[model samples]
Target chain A: MNFKMRQLFAVARHEFLNQFNSFSYWMMFVIPLIVVTALFKYVNLKFNFNNSNFINMVWGFSIPVLTFFFCLIYIGIIANSVARDKTSKLSEMLMSIVDAKEQINGKMLGIYLLLCFQIAFYTIFILILSKVMNNNFLFLFIGRVKIGLIVYSILALFVSLFMFLAITVQFSCFITDTSQISSATMPPMIFLLEFFSLSLLYNSVGFDGDNMIWIFYIICMWPPVGSTLTPSLIASGNISYLFAYSTLIIQIMIMYILYVKSIHVFKYGLLSNKKKNIFIEGFKFR
Target chain B: MIEFKNVSKSYDGFQAVNNLSFQLHKGEILSLIGQNGAGKSTTFHMLLDFIKPSSGNINRNNNLNIGYMPEERGLYLKESIKNQMLYFASLHGMKRVEALKKIKVWMEKLNVVGDIEDKVESLSKGNAQKVQLIACLMFNPDLLILDEPFSGLDPVNADLLIKAVLEAKKSGTMIIFSTHNMENVEKLSDYVVMLSHGKTVLKGTLNDIYNQFGRSKLDIVGYNNLQKFEGMNGIKNIDIINDNSAHITLNDVSFGKYIFDDVTKEGYLPVFNQHYPTLDEIFKTKVKQSE
Candidate 1:
């Protein structure tokens, strides 16, 4: 790697280790895994899941709840991770050594690596637990969900994470004080919650009507929200694989553009002390 | 070497730094002394490329290795001092083993009074500041900028820090530091730039600064007839501190010899001193002049 890449990785590694060693980061990572696992275990014990309905119920409930739980954890983690540097006044020192874009990218990469670890750890634990308990429902659920849909769902999850993390980092750069983090990151959290609510609504009520399907199509095109809704739409057979793929492409493009634009805000916001509108500051590319 | 040619920075309509120019060469320590908001931090920021000058040119190698300590001191409160220093050293491209060795040396050299494994929060305020300095110093940066490095440090710890800075200077690291303390500036600076309200009011060596004001202050003790100098030609003002002692201000340096001769006519006096103004006095006089 080149010098710039080395510096970027140094930042990423530092951030990762710092967060990895923190008590709160572990709370955010481990608690949700335990809570969701217990909830799943309860479902396993309470309901007789010998049919496709049970599979649908379990998968549907798990996706949104898991997403919401992890979202809450990630929101806190990312906010603190970004704000800690600025509030502690470490950002100014780091800024002298590392470029703003490098710092943002490094921080995101570090947290994202941790998120990947969480996902992998959670998946492995769930797999082992299901096998150990001889819970056929998990296998049944996996068998029933088409491979393509499973792939699309994972893709959509990652896309949404990337997009939302960019938004959070952008807003987080504006935080000069730790008290301002929740408020600084509120816009992205609001976006996530709104779509999270929609995911729940569509999953439970079933948007089977033509108009609602069109709305799902529209939601699937909008970045962030689209990333969350695309998988469910595909799983319901409301949208084809091609449309899902197109929306995925659209989401990636939007994420890329948004990330590039956020680089500017990231550069300026990290140094600014004033509280400014995220939209105004984030969109002002210079 | 780094050179700032006619640098000026303004925010909205308020100038933060105005028409500042200076040069720093290898092994030279330049001290920036100014009151709060005197643009000392702004000068450092411009050198670090954190901010751009609205007008002027700063010429230097773009990739010069630099270590900077901001005025508002900070460290990762939750991490061990060792961990944070190693992380920063790695950012500066130092190997882990090298950084560790350097950390041990710096901690001992600075009398940090804590274990390397101690979290920054566990250390006292002064020790934490020492850790911050260690982070900047361990990398052996080509150019080191310390803003208010002396602030919050006790006299003993300040001396330890001073020794460490002088060591860096001896190793040929070009250094610039800003402080309100004129004593440290006099001790460490090869050259000094004093700023007043974003303007360069005094810029030169300590001797040059003192020479500009001349030997205008005289202190005499155990001398009688202090009233003889009152309203005397070439005497600007006189303050009789005690029956036999007085503080005299001269209109010209040449008058020192005249006073010395007059006071010693009878015999040797216990105290009759003639000298240039102190850095503190020069600083005050310059601030007042700019205001």
Candidate 2:
């Protein structure tokens, strides 16, 4: 491998191993399995239901809820890792080797792989639980989870992660202490969560298909906002698969640009120890 | 070779390094001495490109690979000493195997005894410092900039560090460091730069600096009644401890023979040694003059 690639791999490996070494990794993976299993068992013991609509509701709501929970927990891990490095002043050492862009890319890749691993494990757990409970495996895996929805969900999840990463990177630049990173990161995240809830609520109320399509398009194209909203649009069948994919491609391109900008901010923030308004520092490029 | 020309760094309106310029030859060890906040750390930061100069230029002739040990030593407390050393070496462009080998050699040279797998936090302060110093030198960079490398070290460890620095200099590494200890500078520095209030007040070889200050002393122990030369016209200052012994600083070199004659007349003189000014004396005079 070349120098940049080698350095990138080293960073990614360090990040991955550090997370794996933590107690929280196992907790995140196993807690979801237990919760899903317990809920399935409780529902089976409490009622004998031949009602497909009830099952459909549970399935639809559960996937989004579970996905959101997993994503939230994982976001904390990624944010804390970034924050810890900044707080401990290790970011300066990393910057000495590669520029900001490579560092972010490597970190993002590590978190992405970690999320994929969690998602894969949860999917397998659900599949096995269905077989044991004699529920329809096809409905669990394929029927409720359309290929289009799955593709869009993955895309949306990545977009959201990149957006969070960007915001954290920018905030981390202005913060000298790790204690401030959580407060610094909360604003963008709260905005993203609000947008996510609104989109889900609109989908539940059954908005006009065309109006929903327009909303999804706008969200997918938005610079930092697109990360959370794009996938919900895809899952709700508001946008066609082709249109969602195309918009996602454009969103990724925009995220790349924003990623570069945020890395520049992060580079400066890591070295600065003085107190300043994070928002002001993020915009004042030097 | 390295050069910083008219470099000025400012944060807000306050200047950290104000119009600073200096040069380092290939093999000389330059000691940068200053009071706290006198801009020595800022100069080191500019040398490594950690912070940009507001206006001016710092030029390096080649691809400058620098090994920096910051005033606050950068090492993961939880990481094993071997692991941390290897990680740093790899970052400096060494392969893992080579880095490991170099770590072993350095650990042994420093007489560090412990399992290589022990965490850095488990090591004593002096041992941890040795590990940090080893990490800096493991890569054998062309330029080594150490900021207060001996701050928390005891005398023995400090001497060990001085020896290591001397060896690096012999192998042709341009070493620049900042320290508050003037004795270390006297022992190890070939050239010195004394800064006061963000300005270079004194810069030259150690011998040249002391020569320019022109205050010499003679210690006489056996002379009885040395009060005859106490207020001589040739003497700029005279300090007498008891009647037989005195230290005199001369205004002229010609007075050395005159003092010798006067001492000889006092009685059989047992000890009369001329003393050149030390770096400590020169530093005190220079800083006082700046004020």
Output the number of the lDDT-best candidate: 1
DockQ of all models, two decimals each: 0.69, 0.36
Estimate the Cα RMSD of every predicted model relative to the unseen true structure.
2.9, 3.6
TM-score of each: 0.92, 0.87
Q: Relative to the true structure, how large is the alpha-carbon lDDT of every model?
A: 0.82, 0.73
Q: What local lDDT does model 2 show for residue B189?
A: 89
Worst 10 residues of 2 chain A by lDDT: A46-55
DockQ of 1: 0.69
Error of 2 at B33 (Å): 1.5
Question: Tens-digit lDDT track for model 1 on B1-291?
Answer: 999999999999999999999999999999998899999988988899888999999998898888889887698898888888888887888899999999999998988888999888899999999989998888888999999999999999999989999999999999999988888988899999989999999899888888899889999998879997899889999999999999898998899999998889989799888888889988898899999
lDDT of 2 at A105: 73
Task: Show what share of the native A-B interface contacts model 2 retains.
Answer: 0.11
Candidate 1: regions farther than 4 A off: A31-62, A204-220, A273-286
